[model samples]
Target: MAIEYIEGDLIASGEEVVVHGCNTRGGFDTGFAGVVKKRHPAALDAYMEYHRNGGLVLGSVIWAYDGRLIGNALTQPTYGRAGKHISYAAVEACMQSIDDAARNGVPGTPFSGGFTRVSMPLIGADRGGGDWNEIERIVETTLKSVKTVVYVLPGHRPSADALSSRPRR
Candidate 1:
């Protein structure tokens, strides 16, 4: 299990699966959701369809396959109610996503060959207002035994250093 931090665009990182912090309501209006929706409409549409069909819920992870990019968009409920304070649900969702990948070999198609790598922004930190220390601990502990290589992409705004250097709660 290896974790790498890259300061760049999450979408263009080219990881096997790109994890997205999404709301339980299935609205992709802001944050990573908005970016994914703009770049891959099919992914967003699939997420919405799944949500409408009672598939998306708190702590649930949904994989939307993108034909154009030939990759998978892994969306999980980081925020139960949109525009509200972050909750442990985000951490649960994140852990669940990783566990699912390790056990199920990535949701949706495996992209090129299989699910060996994944890229994602800081779960529940940006819009979800989650504590970085807690989020980091949860992620590290969860993936400690996994074999997949995970790349954590920092947000574009604020700068990677700025976000990481912020005082931890």
Candidate 2:
């Protein structure tokens, strides 16, 4: 149950799992998903394929295995539509992703067992129109019992500095 903050790229954070907030339709059009799509097309493809096959749903998580670049991706649905307002369910989805990673290894690799640490951007706050205070509270509460160390990436806005500096619960 440890948390650390580092001001850098979430994809380059070197954690076992990198979590991204995605839409239910599996579109990586912007934000961290766009970076992932550009850097690891294969992983993004797999995620979309899974979504196309009815694998992704709100409040659930799916993994995208990318070899070593960032270990693996844990995609959680933050909203059903791209520009819709976010809900507290996004927090549940994030917690579920962490729990899933702890149970299932990094999706396709045998060498890596389970995630010991995870890096994530501020879920639901960027494009999902969520309040940072509420999202932060939800994150801290949900991750309280988990043993994995979580690294939350700051958003690319002026207020991100204030958000990142919030004390971990």
Candidate 3:
């Protein structure tokens, strides 16, 4: 299936992805399945914690630092809440999670044997304040080899299909 890009409210349909404006407040809405927070460990942790607790992890630190669900992709623990940098070790760990997930399928679901659909927001956009292209490169490279479908939720318009087409560099 091709990746579809739609614009509206993130929480409206519990879509696989929801892009945020510069100052979007992650609220409780089933329209969007997840919110892409700018890369801050605390902020990310809060989002994860909220969701894991069955509260709201759309936009916060608790979720960012709390570790990520091993769904279709493996996510690394957020690093550098104090210093504004993504740790190398953390990156490796995160990549490994993706690898692990790709190999064995997510812990709970039955293994489909191929193609795990994973939707992720571009990391390091907010807190790291880095270039989107560079970050996209990192994400692309990390996830390229896996049999995973990445939902590249960027800005006003991100292509789920285009992301799927990007060959591993």
Candidate 1 on 37-155: residue-level lDDT in tens?
88888778777887789866666566666643222233344444445345565565556565556555643464433354556677666677766566666666665434433334554
Local distance difference test, per candidate?
0.58, 0.59, 0.36
lDDT of 2 by residue, 1-169 (tens): 4345455576665654566666765667777678878877766776778778987666655555656423223333443445545657756656765655555655556424665556666666667767756766666656653443334444546344454476655
Off by over 4 Å in 1: 67-84, 111-114, 145-169
Q: Which of candidates 1 and 2 is the stronger one according to TM-score? A: 2
Model 3, 64: alpha-carbon shift in Å? Answer: 13
lDDT of 2: 0.59
Clashing residue pairs in candidate 2 are none
- Top TM-score: which candidate number? 2
Per-residue lDDT of candidate 3, residues 40-124 (tens digit): 2334454445546765312221212112332211122232224333333333445555544555654333432423444444444
Cα RMSD, each candidate:
4.5, 3.9, 9.4
Reference-based TM-score, model 1: 0.72
Per-residue lDDT, model 3, residue 107, is 37
User: What's the distance in Å from true for residue 56, model 2?
Assistant: 2.4
Candidate 2's C-alpha runs over 4 A off are: 68-84, 110-112, 145-155, 158-161, 164-169
Taking the candidates one at a time, how many backbone clashes does each contain?
A: 0, 0, 29
Worst 10 residues of 2 by lDDT: 68-77
